[model samples]
Target: MMKRKILVLKYSFLAILLILLNTFNVNGQDEFVKKSFTTADPLYTNLLKATEGNFKNYPHSFLENGNIKYYQIDEWTGGFWPGSLWYMYEYTKEEKWKKAATAWTNSLESNQYNTKHHDIGFMMYCSYGNALKFDDNPKYKEILIQSAKSLTQRYSPVVGSIQSWNTRKSKGDINLWEYAVIMDNMMNLELLFYASKVTNDPVYKNIAINHAAKTMQNHLRADYSSYHVVNYDPKSGKVLHKQTLQGFSDESTWARGQAWGIYGFTTVYRETKDKRFLKTAVKMANFFLDHPNLPKDKIPYWDFNVGQPGFKPDWDFDPKRFKETPRDASAAAITSSALLELSTYVKGKQKQKFYNAALAMLKSLSSDTYLNTNNANPYYLLKHSTGNLPSNREIDVPLIYADYYFLEALTRYEKSK
Candidate 1:
C-alpha cells in the first residue's frame, strides 16, 4: 500500500511539470513581449506625461518650429492619434488609454457621413476598426459601416478602382494626376472588407476586391515596384498618365508607396485568404528587401531608385538629390507589421526571411534615433519620418501614423510569440 501511494505521488508530480513546460512553450511570444515591455513601458508613460494637457487637440503631424500641429476631424490623419491610444489600451489594458481612445474616437463621429474624398478608411478604420477589434463595441461597428458607405461613394465602376484624390490644389501636388488612383489608396480597402463581413453584404467586399484587382494590374511596374499615382480619365476610365508625386521621380520607387503595397496586399490576403494576394505581397516585399539602395539597417531612404545609373528625374531634376536623403521610419513601421503577418502565412526560408526582416526593422525603430521618448514630444513616438519631402513639408518629423503602426507591430509581435 505504501509503495502504491508513492508511485501515485510521483506520477502527479511529473504531470504538473509537463503542464508547466507546455505553458512556457506556448507563450514564447509573451516572454519576448515581457522583455520588450521593459523598454516600451517607460516610453508610453513619458508620452502620457508629455501630453497631459494636450489631448483635447487632434495632432496630425509635427512642425519644424517645434510645435504640434493640429488637424480638423476631416483630415486624413486625424484618426491615427486615437488609433495609437487604442493600441496602448490593448497593450496595457489600462483605463486611461481606453478613456482617451473613447474621447478621441468619438470626436470623429461626424466623419462617418463626410464624403469629400476616399480616406474614411484611414480616418475611421484606423480609429474605430481598432476600437472594435479590442473592445468589440457595436457602436463602433455601426460607425464603420457608415464610413464604408461614404467610401463607396468615391468608387467608380468605370474605373474599377476608388479615386484617390481630387484635382491637385498646388504645384506641390503630383503633375498630371487629376483623377488619380494611388497605391496608397489600396490601404483603404480594409474598412470595406470588414464592413462586408459584419453586414453580410457582398457589395462592399466586391468593391474592395475589384479595386484591389484593378490597382494590382495597373499600379505595379514591370519589376514589381509600384507607381505612386496612376491618373485615370474619369470619363472613359482610361489610363491617362503615371506619375510619382512623392517619390524621387515617375520612374523611382517611393519607399512608403512600396510599404503601402505590401501592407495593403497582405491585408487583402488576410481578409480573403487569396493566394494571389499573398504572392503579390511577396513580390512587393522582395522588391523592397532586395533593392540595392535599401539601407543596411533595413530602413529605406525616402525613395530607393533615386540615384541609380541612368536614373534621371524629369527635366534636370538633380540626379545627385540622393545625397544624405532622409529615412522614412513610417515606411519601416508599416512594413514591419505586414511582414510579421506574412511570416505566419508562409513557411520555410521565406517565412524566416520575412520574420527576420520584420524583427530587424522593429529593432531599428526601437532605437533612440527613431524612438522619441524625450520630453520634446509627449504625444508621439518614433521620429525622422518623411512626409511629402518633395514639397519640403513635414520633413524629418514625427507622423501620427508612424506611432500607430509601430504600436501595432509591437502588439503583433507580442501576440505571435
Candidate 2:
C-alpha cells in the first residue's frame, strides 16, 4: 500500500509540473528581436513611428470614450505634434509628415497659444523652429512672432519675471505663483530672445535676461543644487522663498529638474554668452555626476532623493516605479543631450569630462536591459518615466520628453559622425 501511494504521488507531481510548464509563456520570444526587451526600444520605435514607420493606418489621438480624434480636430495641436514627426521627416524626406505638420501650422491665428509659462520655448522651439527649418514658410515666422508677443505680454513689470501657470480669474490678483521659475524656464528665455530678433525689440531681450539673472541669484543654493520653484513678492519682485515643490523637497534636487537646469543654463550660455550661467551649469552638472546615489548604469531616479531606505514615499509619490521602484532613464537621456551641448561651451579637461559623461549616459541607455524594442511595446528607449506625479502612476513607462531627447541625441551623434 505504501508503494502504491508513492507511485500515485510521483505521477501527481509530474502532472503538476506539466501544467505549470504550459500555463505561461515562460520563455516567450519577441517577434523581431533576438534578445529580450530593453527600456529604450519602444521609445525608439515610437519616435520612428511618429515619423517613419507604417503610419498609414495610424490612429488619431484617442478620446476618453475611445473614439478617433484626427488632426484639425480644433483642440488637438498638429503644430507641436510635428516636432517629433519632423525628426522622421528629416531622416526619410517624407512629405506626408510635413503635410500633417502643416495642417496645424496653417491652423494658427494671432499669438493665442503662447502660454504665460515656462513652456513657451518648448512650444515654439519645436513647432516654429521646425517650420523655419523644413518648409521656410514665412507664415511660420509670423506665427512665432505672435507667439512671442503673447509670451512677452505676460512679463510682470513688478516681478521682473514671467508669471507661470496664471489664470486670469484672479481679478487682477495673480493666481499663479509669481516668483516661480522652473528649470524648464530656461527654454522660455529663448522665445523672448528670438522674439527680440524678429521684432527688433530690446524689451523682450531685457525680460529674458532679467528673469534668468533673478533665477540664478535666488533658485540656486550654495551646494550647487537648486530648487524647483522660487516664490517672490510680485510687487517688489524680490524673492520671498525658494523650494522644490515638484521634487522630494523644497531643498532636494529632482533628477529631471537638474537635467532642465543643465540644459537650460547651457542654452542660456549659448544665446547670451553669460560666463556666470556657464559656471553655474558646470557646478550643477558636477553635483549630478558625482552623486553616489545614482544607479550603477548612471541612470537616475525620478527623484534624486529616491532609493534611500528611510525615504518613505507618500501617496503622491510618482517617482517611476517598475514593479519595484526603478531609475528614470528619461532623465538620463535628457542630461546626456545637455551634457553634449554643454561640452561645446566648456574648455580643455572640462570639455572632455562633460562629453565623456554624456556619451556614457547614451551608452547606458543603449544597453539591452534599458531599452524595450524586443517585446510587444518595442520602440521606446528610456523607461520608468512619469507623466504626472499628482496621480502617482505611469510608473516605469515611456514619456514623450524621453523620446524627444533620446532621438535628438541620436540625431546629433549621427549627424556628427
Candidate 3:
C-alpha cells in the first residue's frame, strides 16, 4: 500500500512539471511579440514631424543646391513625398499623415499621362500603391491604371523591352539611344503588373514579363551584375552597345542600380510566384553581398568598381581625391527593404542571412552616422546618399526617396517579425 502511494506522488510531480513548461513557452512567445511588434520607434514620429514642417516650406523633393526646394510632377522623385506620408500613416495609423498623403498624391494627377520617361511608376505607384493597399479607393486605382497604360506607350515589341530614353549626343561625340533600355526601367514594371491585376488585362502583364525576360538575357553579366543601359537597333532589335550612364563604367556595378534590380525582381516574384525571378534575385543579391567592396555595415559605395585598380571612368569630377568615397544610404534603404521581403520567400540559411543583413543595415541607417536627427535638415531623414556622382549632382546629400524606403523598411520589419 505504501509503494502504491509513492508511485502516485511521482506521476503527480511529472504532471506539474509539464504544466509549468507549457506556461513558460506561452509567456516567451508573448514577450517576443511585445518586444518586436508593440514597441514603436520614437525616431519615426520625430522624422515625420520634421518632414511635415519642411514640406510646409518646400512642398517637394528634399534639399537641393543647399536649399529646400520642390520638383515638377514629372520629376522621378515627386511621388516619394506622398509615398513617405503613406508609410508614416501605415506605421502610426494617424489621420494627419493620410490627409497629407492624399493632398500630395493628388498633386501628381497630371503625371498619369506623362510619358517623358520610364519613372511614371515611381511617380504614381509609390504614392497611390500604398493608398490603394490600405484604402482601396477607386480613384487611386484609376490613376494607377492610366499611368500604367501611359508607360506601355514606351514598350518596343521588336526589342522586347521598354525604351528608357531618346537619342542624345555627348561632347565626346558619342551618340546614344537609337534604342536605350536602362536598368532603372526594371522598377517601372511593377506598375504594369499591378495594372494587369486590377484591370484583368493580360497585356500589361505581358509587357512587363517580356521586358523582364529580355533584360535578364541581355543586361546582366555572368557574375549577375547589371549594365546601366543597353542600346539596340530599333527596327531589327539587334544589340548595339552595352554601356554605363550612371555607374563608374560599362563594367561596374552601380550600387543603386543593383539595388533596383534586386527590389524589382523580388517584387516580380511576389506578383507572379515565379521561381525563376526568385532565383535571379538570389543570384544578384549574392553578387552584391559577396563583393569585396561591400562595406562592413552593408551600405555600398556609389559605384562598386569605381575605386578599384585599372579602371578609369568619366565623371564630372575626380572621385579619387576624396579621402573616402561617399556611401549611398538610398541604396541601403532600398536593399534592406528588398532583403526583408526576400527573406520571407526563402528558406534555411539563405533566409536567415538575408534577414540578418537587413537588420544590420537598419541598425547602421538608424545610427547618428546616417540618421538626420538634428533639426538642421528636417526635410530629410537620412543623410550621405549619393545621386548621379558622375554628373556631380546631389552627391552625399539627402534624397526624398531615401527617407521613403527607410520608413518602408521599418514598416516591413515590424510586419515580418
lDDT ranking, high to low = 1, 3, 2
TM-score of 1: 0.87
Q: For candidate 2, lDDT tens digit of each residue in 1-417?
A: 999999999999999998887654332212111121233334434544554533222222323342333343122233345465565556556686676555444444433464535465665666677667778777777777777777777678777777765533221232346456566676677777777888888887888888777767877889778787776677787776665655655557778888878877887788789899899889989989988787767888777776465544333454353465556776887788888888888799998888878777766666556655444343443455653343344445665456567656655544543
Deviation in Å, model 3, residue 114 alpha carbon: 1.2
**lDDT of the structure predicted as candidate 3:** 0.81
**For model 1, the run of ten residues with the poorest summed lDDT:** 169-178
Q: Which candidate wins on lDDT? A: 1
Q: Where does candidate 1 clash, by residue pair?
A: 29-417
TM-scores for all predictions:
0.87, 0.75, 0.86
Residue 197 alpha-carbon offset, candidate 1, angstroms: 0.7
User: Roughly what TM-score does model 3 have, to 2 decimal places?
Assistant: 0.86
Candidate 1 residue lDDT tens string, 62-174: 67566667777787887898888898788878898898788778888889997888888999999898888767788889999999999999999999999888866423443
Which residue segments of model 1 deviate by more than 4 Å? 1-56, 169-176, 315-323, 373-376
Which candidate leads in TM-score? 1
